[model samples]
Target: MSQHTFLTLDEVASNLKVTRQTVSKYIQAKELNAVKINKSYRITIKDFENFVNSNSTSQEPSISYLRKTKNCTLQYSDKSDDFEVVHGIFHGELRSLSNNGKLTPNKFIFGDNYFVMKKLLETHRGKVDLIYIDPPFGTGQDFNSIDEHPAYSDKLVDGEFLEFIRKRLFLIRELMSDSGSIYLHIDKKIGHYVKIVMDEVFGYQNFINDITRIKCNPKNFARNAYGNYSDMILYYAKHRDNQIWNDIRESMSEEKRKELFPKNHSKLGYYTTNPIHAPGKTLNGDTGLEWKGLKPPKGRHWRYSREVLDELDEQGLIEWSGNGNPRKIVLAKEHKGFKIQDVWEFKDKGLSYVEYPTQKNHDMLERIIRNSSHYNSIVLDCFAGSGSTLRVADKLGRQWIGIDNSTHSLNVIQKSFKEDNINFELLEYVPLD
Candidate 1:
């Protein structure tokens, strides 16, 4: 007998000619055997065969329907050309520009990120904890400062642009720890293609979120299409369920806070009341029992045990209505805030108000850093642009590395860091032919 292999939910669905949800139902009903791994389910070939034999009356062999599943990946001409490009064994030299005498100085490299990242792999492979890059959006246009000074050119479009990012992604993957994550920010025009490339680089199973970032206010465009005010951020983990995720919640706005907690207690502050009974019936539990001469409503059970209800009533946390109904009082001050969603609104400042073109919002970077990384975690940004990620990482107490080839970007980073009293080591990449 051949050794059995494990299959994903998708592969099982394909072989069974059924939906993935049906396979999941089989797992839930214990009609099929499956194991939970990380955040997903995996079924063994033996279990799959057992399921088929038990369900079908036909005399067909189960192995006949089970085909080896093909791993989906994007293919394009010269996509492998990136791996063919070889560099010399020379390690680029690092010159310490300004060291704050800390144990590990943050790095700000002024060089091509491809070569710089290769240099980084020599000492930092599988060490970085988080990476965030806002690379050129493949628009085939040059960005400039408000004073018309050249910033950088995004001349690589279409396949060439995809190859550019794909090559860097391969290197970035090597530099990431098993628990690391990366977030790529790009415009919507070419974001879908980039997502496919990312899915190929990082396993499709590790793909996490495609966040929609509102970059600007609604525009009145002269064209027939609607105004474009958003871009996308593709987030992925080196390994699913192993990456750092702080689950940061968004603070409720003042208006929303007031609306939800309308009643204000003279001593306890703002609060709201909820019914003491819940939707489901408890057949024989204590929650189904009566408390203080009040039975739960029909087809409902008390949200808590009668003992806990009595404790709450004694503590004055329960309010009784005129009709003799008890409700639980929830204080707004005790709320933990709302969960962060996929859609974000962080408008970029005008070019005149920024030192570099297309500079991202600092608060938005702060949110990403706080949610995805921890103190002293190594954060990397290859397409450093205006160094928003580095600044936010430094402020959040994470060590950072920033790499950019543009002279204008390097100057802006140096100036900004100097003004902020940030100490870092600057290096230049010199390729040896």
Candidate 2:
């Protein structure tokens, strides 16, 4: 197997018992990596070896070994129909190291999305609190192929991509618990189409937010407009009334803290209080009662009931301006981080990109995963390109199911997880070996 010497095309043809024309065809096709020296075609011994090794009849082409790694699995506490099972998962005590943390492989799925989906259904369906995915935008990789080869189209046109997403989105909806929400990622190319599809399935009014992510510094484009710089993530729920969303409160800023609580020094944690009344009528347009010597502000009403005010005043939660409106006392720290801004973004904070075109940042993924999901929640990324989504989900103590058709992506994801110390918390490693 030591290929210390190069081989000529004629020699390769002879060795493989192919004709010269067949060998030349491969050379012209760039299928064989050969160098040209003074009109002489020469194949490097390493390139020759790699070519030979990559020619394995497996249905999948081997990828660069040094490029990526992996070792993690999505697990579930319940089971259901429709989800596929991923067999041949390697079982072992192997581990991986990472900068954020270490992990060990607890389970493995050496199969495709449908295969993995079955397993997820068996394990996590109806148990997930949130399901967020950044599916492939239909890049025509073998991963998205239904017939086992790379599709010739970018993604199916005429609602092809729509239907493609619709199928998986429906499954994700089924897998989620009644209180769950789904935040899907897509580019503008089909973001709206995908949204329409999601509305058709998940209901339109259930739509929450359209999250825009800043992926890069804006890659160079030949277009008339500015180079594209963001990706849109659409949020939706199964039922608007059935969704589980916490109305989180953020600590007041230093200025806001002092401005509102100017006379207080309660710095334990920043908090805020509502004034005696809100400058608005009731939701039904009914005004509130007068207090002391003043009627509630015009078109406004008491934010709290007399009984609630009495309780707050008793608990020191009430603030009086002596001559103006009454304010409630709150810890300035009670304000959550920035009121959960609609635009979520991350710019080269500490992590570097994977260098692959269209690769999402792991740092960006961490934010989405943390904000949308919780510990041990079920997360699904059907277009789970690069597997970064799954990697972050695993680290965040979440169980996940990632479905990608690209053997290249699968390889990148696997190797990324394996080589990383991400496998310490894991149970074992079943390298696709």
The prediction achieving the highest lDDT against the true structure is 1
For model 2, the local distance difference test gives 0.58
Model 2 Cα lDDT, one tens digit per residue, 1-433? 3222544453354344455578778889998887664444656556655766778687544433211111111112232211121222332322322323533333333344444454456556766667667666765542322223332224454356665566566567657776688888788887876776665455445678888877657678887888887778898875565666655434456676577645544534444566677676765432476555566777778877766777877776766776766787766444444566667566433223342335567777776677666677776666666666777888888877555555555556667766874442211223343
Clashes, model 2: 55
TM-score of each: 0.82, 0.53
Model 1 weakest lDDT span, ten residues long: 80-89
* Reference-based TM-score, model 1: 0.82
- lDDT (tens digit, per residue) of candidate 1 on 366-398: 998999898999999999988999999998999
| Candidate 2 Cα errors over 4 Å, as ranges | 1-108, 118-125, 139-158, 217-223, 247-330, 336-338, 347-352, 424-433
